[model samples]
Target: MLEVIGLSSAAQTLYAALVERSPATLAELGHDTATAARLEELGLVTRLPGDPPRYVAVSPELALDVLIQARTQQLTEARHRIAQLAARFHRSAPEQDSANLVEVVMGRQAVSRRFERLQREARRQVRVFDAPPYATGAAGNAVEFELLARGVEYRVLYDRRAVEAPGTLATIIGYLGAGEQARVGEVPVKLVLSDHPMAILPLRHDEHAVESALVVHDSTLLGALSELFEMYWERAAPLHVRRGRLAEATGAAEARRDLLPLLAAGLSDTAIAAHLGWSDRTVRRHVRAMMTRLDAQTRFQAGYQVVMRGWLAEP
Candidate 1:
């Protein structure tokens, strides 16, 4: 390590010693030189034949200038190596931000930040094809609210099969009531995106799958998506269709119908909470209430009774 910074010192000592003695043994060449080992380690001297001892430095005084040249070469090689390492890392950069195109962002936070920036810049409208099953949760909703509050025109398309949670439905209606246009329909894929500046996340079913996000801000691309969303919106149902269900059923009943089977399959409350976007306490309460409703002493018994009653078999 010290060899790199001490190269100049090492070169000077080796050359000075050689200038004094044309040919000398290793001991005589750098008898008491601090950098003797460093010079020999650098191949600046050679051992020669002699009974007592003999060593010859590679070059004499005038040509000993090669030491400085060698030093320059070493510095150049070091800089080139560092530059190559920097270039390699540059190529591995996650998102490529360019003036005229969408940026590809990797990892969760970067993707979310790009989406937030788009929402902040939006003016005329914001159109969405929401794939709730792949939703990024609270952080995403906060950004949605931010855009809606700015009076940006907002449109969302939701998958019909999404198991809507309590406040989630209310939130949607509230957004729609505030002039945001929302629609629900079935889609073959799971994703959430908007026009112009849009973010997308692929559906992931594996436990170890990485979450990826992308944001596109190009105007032409945004316009094309806006048109596609408008066409889909024409055939989509409004949030009002499902708002009634939340009012008619208790939260426990909703949980019983939706989460009982998953719970019985040995999923923990946290996993259920993450999947359904419900609080752990809420999930636990629902489980306890279901146990009482079935007159069962435990969750296992309640699950057994639920299946026995054919509720599990119902659509």
Candidate 2:
């Protein structure tokens, strides 16, 4: 881990040994003078004058702070260079072939990093078609929360399958609570569109992993994607947290009200129960009661009644 801050593997090992047992002779730590000298140069170890000089590990809290600062500055400079290169590329894009508008990013890590960078660079909003053969198991986007805090809007359209995936509905609910505008419907592809002039969609050669992605920069293609999102958004059912007087209500009314969005989103009882942390039996009971109360004979009618009755109001 210390390699990220420019420490060699050997130096990191010597530093760890010194940290565990400090003020020891290099010979005792099984390290040569060169390794100890490297650590000392990095300000991670101190050499004291003695018959056979011993090295003391510097306080990690103090030593690592300087290294971290230097690393941060380096990263900042790299970002500047990347910005310059991107600007140059954009300037030359018009003279290049139309094929240059789509850049293929290969490998899972590369795809994931580009996705994160796209979201991070968004100036106004991000629209997503989130279906997921996820590159990472992480269910939530920490970058999204940061963007939300910065007042960047998020409009995410989740496929029903994505919502039904383990722990996904709960995570979606968390994003909704954080002011994301979310809806549930059929998402044809896994896509992310930022306010920037680019959009990314994962290539579907492998269904189990996001091994590659295409970053599209063509204005016509981007406009089509934006229209596609709107079309889906119009058909998708909005998802929101239960709130206001209904939230403060008690008993079956509150329970059924809480279940409205899940029903509207067409989740099965088991999926809804998992999302709400309720037993399967409890979810079934509520669905039956809610249907009876609405005079609906089927789950579909019951969900329609929920919307007609305006039970899924914004929180």
Candidate 1 lDDT, 51-166, residue by residue in tens = 74555566543334555577789999999999999898778653453553554566655655655666666665665666544335543366666677776777777654442433
Report, for every candidate in turn, its global Cα lDDT versus the true structure: 0.57, 0.83
Per-residue alpha-carbon lDDT of candidate 2 for residues 1-315, written as tens digits (9 for 90 to 100) = 888998999999999999999899988989899888888888999999997998999999999999999999999999999999999998988778587878999898898899899988888999999887777558468888889989999999999889888778668767878889988877878889988867999766458448989998857888998889889887777787654121222566577667887788888988887777788998898889888989999998998887787777734
The residue ranges of model 1 lying beyond 4 angstroms of the native Cα positions read 1-100, 138-140, 163-167, 188-210, 219-223, 241-246, 249-315
- Candidate 2, after superposition: displacement of residue 268 in Å? 1.0
**Candidate 1 to truth, TM:** 0.40
After superposition, the stretches of candidate 2 with alpha carbons farther than 4 Å from their true spots are 1-97, 243-250
What's the lDDT of the predicted structure labeled candidate 1? 0.57
Give Cα distance to truth, residue 77, candidate 1, Å. Answer: 47
What are the C-alpha RMSDs, in order, of all predicted structures?
Answer: 19.0, 16.5
Maximum-lDDT candidate:
2
